[model samples]
Target: MCLNLPQMQSRLLLISPGQSYRLAPYLKAAERLGVSLTIVSDSRYSLTREVADGIQGDFTEPSALLDAIIAQAQTTPFSGVVASDDSTVELAARIATRLGLPTNSIASATLSHRKDLARRQLQAAGLPVPEHWQLDLAREIAPQLQGLPYPVVLKPVSLSASRGVIRANDPDEAAQACRTIARIIAPLSNPIERQTLLIECYLPGQEVALEGLLQQGVFTPLALFDKPDPLTGPYFEETYYITPSRLPDAIQQRIRQTVADACRIYGLHQGPVHAELRIDGNQVWILEIASRTIGGECSRSLDAVLARPLEEYVLAAAMGNPLPVERRSGASGVLMIPIPRAGVLRRINGVQEIRTLPHITDIRISMESGQVVETLPEASSYLGFIYSTADTPQAAEQALRNAHRALDITIDPLLNS
Candidate 1:
């Protein structure tokens, strides 16, 4: 089946903050769907000569960007407006509303980005959320730390990819973590984004990621990923994602129901939802939910199992087209190569050896040699992604583990820079 949508409009506007691996796939999906896309970006570095219809705008200033989009729409009306990642979600939501395109509301987008607000909304809806306190970065944080439970997590309100997320074991460590995280937040150009941090009691359990879609307030699950590695942390760095989840049927249903409930609580009626949850036996807690698909190259695992590209489904959803929710057969997994140290990347060895392993479908090393690499608690990207598939979840996971062990990575000191 081609997954063709004849009713979708021919033109679209994509708002992306920079050049990312995400752009090429979306462009390919648009081409396959016979849709013309106009790239709207804040940075021109990632825009290539191939993108003939491109616009540069101030992404941080939504009102000005909306005007620019409106002017462009007058010349060529858009069938849909979509954002590639979290940074552009709000802008895309606003543009879509003005153009009468399908999208989540601005309030939904805001809740998706702000952790504190999302937590409050969920808690009020009688949902299970961690006990959390919001600390204003602009004022003294010392007074706010009193009487809170030990072993809390300190993280910036809006940052993603686990950047600036730290675990503090005590009051003293929490204070230091707050100061460190605030310093990380201080240089951000968005002042409103820089002013708050969330202090929440750290839940102890295995983590899982849910990838699904919503259409007119109805939920359709796509895949559920199991994070085999324990994410308990001083700094939580996610490395592995294996799916066709190994959890029992009851647990999986609960996870799905909880995430769907969260969507309703936040008023997110449409688009892809990438959610993080913590589970200990039957008790499940929602960590974070975004109006986007799985982040990074991890989405590749789903692509390997699906008949159509994941981007194609996302694009179809944005156009208000019905998508087949069923996934292709088999167990697939992805390993996000974690950076061991903060330094300059020198070189990666054993790529051929890793690829030759049984059941190893593909491997991509995203960071080039000589690029400065930073690890978790400070950085937002990964070194590369490894993909694998097999008849069983254990076999698929083992294949990824074997492939990961075959390579050697070298990182030079920051002084070399």
Candidate 2:
């Protein structure tokens, strides 16, 4: 979709700063459209938050933060609010609604960010989705699950990037795994036992994502990407996303149609969308959907591969401006560097060699020398990303993975510190 011409000057308030974690694309998209950006608050642990301007109160407290932002926004006349992480997307929607601006419905935001809620909602809508259930931390394991199967996925309902997400082979294993998940959030919430849990029937097949723009609950599939690594069971950390997913045309159509129905069923409005689908046979299961934008280095992939200005689409939509319907053509992919353990930053190898590949467009390493990096203490652990675009999807896909494997990483722990 082509964004209508810019009607007026627009200034946007970015809720969180960008990085490899998530929402980096949202910030980059705003930059592409030349939208004036003021950092609202920082949620990550990096030193980057100091670069942000408005760091008032706290972000987790939705009401307090909302009031502060609205109070300040009235004077600044911030055109809109945006959040890129699953942790705060709903809050972003709430702030927009509170300000009487065009925003996604909070109920919709809740459905998208919380996996268990989304699955149930989609099931009600009769959309294809994974079989999942809510695991109350304080409740006993389901009695029927004693004879159940293994490899079931257990995760936090509202968490993303695989945070607190794990898999169990049997009910006994499931009970132990639930204990570990329960411990991770104790400091973050009181009576954390009430935290939402998801035990899902693990669906196997090639994992693919649909990147697009959703206008008034209508989903427009822009590009399809494939996940090379097996995302089932265990952790959900993504490794590579190569666009022009190798799926046949028929399968691609089915994926798009299924995702479109999901966006509508979940109340997605005008904005960027990131969707995950697992296909086995003719069955297509909707994994998750993000209302704000795609996480990881996907925006970079679309930029380098599709050769389009995605930031513009996000900026225009957030400002109530028309989104650019047509995107530049080309195939693109992004490789996310995975973490094996936590320790001090050391060194990276093979980037220079990988960059030598003809299809490789650019390579970025977010980890700094001497900086501490760890395996997803909770699943969002990625050091950096590799981006590439080419004439053919195969070439782009091959070049990205080959380049990624060729790259090396070295980490030395700062044990005493």
Candidate 3:
């Protein structure tokens, strides 16, 4: 969509966790568009406070946080609220609602983050959803697995980026996966989320992600990403996201329509939406939809398609500016460099060579040499991200793959610690 700059400098409240990679992009976008950005986070040590006015509150205690925000609003009122990560979307919605700003309903925001609730809502709306049921971690799980479908995916109700998401092929595997995921959730601070898991019949098909925006219940398609890697797995660690999808034009249109329908069902009437879906033959199953943009540095790929960083669109929309819908052209992609094992990073090689490869735009290694790294099913962070833009989806996909191949990464085993 084309940008419609706001008439005056609009003050925005951005609710983002301290660890989010999204803060910087939004900050830069706000500066370019002349928006006054205030960062509200749960961390006192947030670096964003150095530049932007920041408010730190205990996100777990929303009532207190809202009170603090309201107090600040009385002096320097905020025109809108935006959530920079999935973990903060519900809180953002609540804040927006309390301030009488445009936002999704609190129930809709909550449903978007909780898989179990979202599945039920979608099914009730007659959307194509997989067979699913919730399991209580506090109860005996073995008997509950009896007569259930084989090859099901067990995932935490609240976690995103595929953390604690595992696929099991049999009862034994399911039981074991349940126990492991339980342990993963145990350390989490949310007690309610720690006690629930969503188990669904695994749908087999190629996966694709749609990045779009919504305004007053109308959806605008921004970009559609093709996940070239086969996500069929015991653990789904996302890799390459290449767009302009190779799929037929008709199928892509259907995918966009399905997502728009989901937004209506979720009552998401404003801001950015990121959705993941699986296509099996003519059937399109909704896997996930978030009331936020695509996570991590993956959103950088959209810059080539949108002709501006996606954060600009997100920020402008939050300020109630109308965005012009632009047709996507050319091809761009990103590879979320995966952590190969659990250990401390020791060394990285071939970075210079990878930078020289054709179509490779940038490579960022987010982890330091002495920092610890982990693999998926337990890990949430990627080693870094590799970006590329090309003439076609095939070329873009190949560039990312080629860049990954050039990397020689080494990690010391965790047992040695």
Arranged by TM-score with the best first, the candidates are 3, 1, 2
By lDDT, the better pick of 1 and 2 is: 1
* Cα shift from native, residue 384, model 1 (Å): 0.5
Q: Better model by TM-score, 1 or 2?
A: 1
- Model 3 misplaced stretches (Cα beyond 4 Å): 1-9
Give the TM-score comparing model 1 with the true structure, all chains together: 0.95
Instruction: State every prediction's TM-score relative to the real structure.
Output: 0.95, 0.88, 0.96
Candidate 2 to truth, TM: 0.88
Superposition error at 323 for model 3 (Å): 2.8
Give one digit per residue, the lDDT tens place, for model 1 in 1-417: 112223445688887866756787788888888778888888767563366478777887777877777777776777787788888888888888888777888999999988999999999999999999988877877788888897899999888888899999888888888888977889877787788889899999899999988889998888899999998889999988999889999999999999999999999988889999999878999999998878647888997678777778888877767668657888999999999899999999989999889989999998999999998788878889999999888999999899888889999989842
Give candidate 2 regions above 4 Å deviation.
1-9, 17-28, 42-55, 141-145, 187-194, 412-417
Write one digit per residue (lDDT tens) for candidate 3, span 102-150: 8888899998898888999899999999999888888999987877888
Q: For residues 276-371, what per-residue lDDT tens digits would candidate 2 score against the true structure?
A: 889898889898887756764557787754445666666777787766566666778888878767788788888788778888888888778888
Candidate 3 C-alpha RMSD relative to the actual structure: 3.5
Best by TM-score: 3
What's the ranking of the predictions by lDDT, best on top? 3, 1, 2
Estimate the TM-score for candidate 3.
Answer: 0.96
Would you list the C-alpha lDDT of every candidate in the order shown? Answer: 0.85, 0.72, 0.89
